[model samples]
Target: MTRDNDTERRRPDVRTSLDQWLDSRRGVLRKGIAASTAFTLGASAATGAASAQQDAPFGAVEFQNQTSDGTTVVVDSAILERGGFVTIHDGRLFEGQVTGSVIGVSDYVEPGGADHLTIDLFDVPGAQFDQSQLQNTQPLVAMPH
Candidate 1:
């Protein structure tokens, strides 16, 4: 009977200790969940900010050309001054050219963004302009925009 009374006396202390351990574990778990949630929200905010910046508009270029064969070449801002010339598998290529009465064959100026140049040509003699002729040719400006 004495032994039973002693065990009964210790029951409340054991229960209190177990309860404190569980509460401590729950606090750690809550902190972990909070940290994870904060990290996720921060990453989402950064991605949203980057996407908004990318959505802003940039510079563009336009090209207008007329060939002697009566074929009009109207290249949009994307195709004009694309760093290199357009080439075909058969070895035919056309680079940006500048000449009198070429309509819109002039160096491009981006102003704030990247600088690019667009040279429009009119009345090209042959079926197409020779790509090799533009090789190692430097533009009037250093930036070529």
Candidate 2:
């Protein structure tokens, strides 16, 4: 007979730590966003050159080191560093615009979690990503090359 020991126990299948947090705090996140958006603080002023894309246009992105640091990373807008395109050592080929700015991470669950958060660093003029369904996401400290 097969004995179900601690070493043989199967853990729940959770794709990512970020997903876990989202399932637990769905209401809080939605409400928070609504409340914050409702209270417009400042007027829509003209953004300076600093907010502009400072590097070679990205044709795609491959996330490296995608993990959750017990905090939520909201996909607001890109706060790009005014520089050149970053290349990834072994980054997966992504084809689209990148989202999110918050960078926080704990550790990725190796067995069933992502390895890294890498973004393609190519030059794609008139490229943009659709982020209509973007919500609270797992914190990641990914670096693209």
Candidate 3:
């Protein structure tokens, strides 16, 4: 994972920039803070800046560590400046970096915010990687793309 320290927050025109932003921060779940909180807020703020002038692309996701049925995940909130999707990963924090693989993904969301969003797990058919159901004991990350 990489940290985006750039003070100038410009709207990215490609998915790679969003990927970089999502990978920018990785931290252990601390008391009162979710692991993906920083990135979520950062992404919101970055896109918020651009939105101030126009309808700029933005994305943010925030959720608490919670129990799951191993078949789905419910995100507390997700905001996409444009149409996009959210992904759930079997993420773990190692040396302040996240490492894991995507395990689930939500269907295409319309441009706006969603709460209590439930995403079905491992529904991709003929996937090349492991498609096992999510585990309750597994650390997870909810990322918007």
Choose the strongest candidate by TM-score. Answer: 3
**TM-scores of the models, in the given order?**
0.18, 0.16, 0.53
lDDT string, candidate 1, 39-128, tens digits: 324445666756643442332323233232222233333321223221111112113221211222333333442323333333233434
Candidate 3 achieves a global lDDT of 0.62
Better of 1 and 3 by TM-score: 3
Q: What is the C-alpha lDDT of each candidate?
A: 0.33, 0.29, 0.62
Clashes of each: 4, 18, 0
| Every candidate's CA RMSD | 25.0, 19.5, 13.0
For model 3, the run of ten residues with the poorest summed lDDT: 26-35
Q: Give the alpha carbon lDDT tens digit for every residue of 1-145 in model 2.
A: 3565653556555666656765664543433333222222112223433333332222222343343332222222222222222222111112112222312222222222232333322222343333322234422323321
Candidate 1 colliding pairs: 105-120, 108-117, 108-145, 116-145
CA lDDT, candidate 2, residue 34: 30
**What residue pairs are clashing in model 3?**
none
Candidate 2 displacement at residue 78 in angstroms: 16
Q: Top lDDT: which candidate number?
A: 3
| Residue 112 alpha-carbon offset, candidate 1, angstroms | 6.4
Over 4 Å off, model 2: 1-83, 87-125, 139-141
| lDDT (tens digit, per residue) of candidate 3 on 1-145 | 2345453355455678656655654322231133333433445665564453343345777878788778888989888777677777665343344324556678888899788889877774454455457645877777776
Local lDDT at 10 for model 1:
67
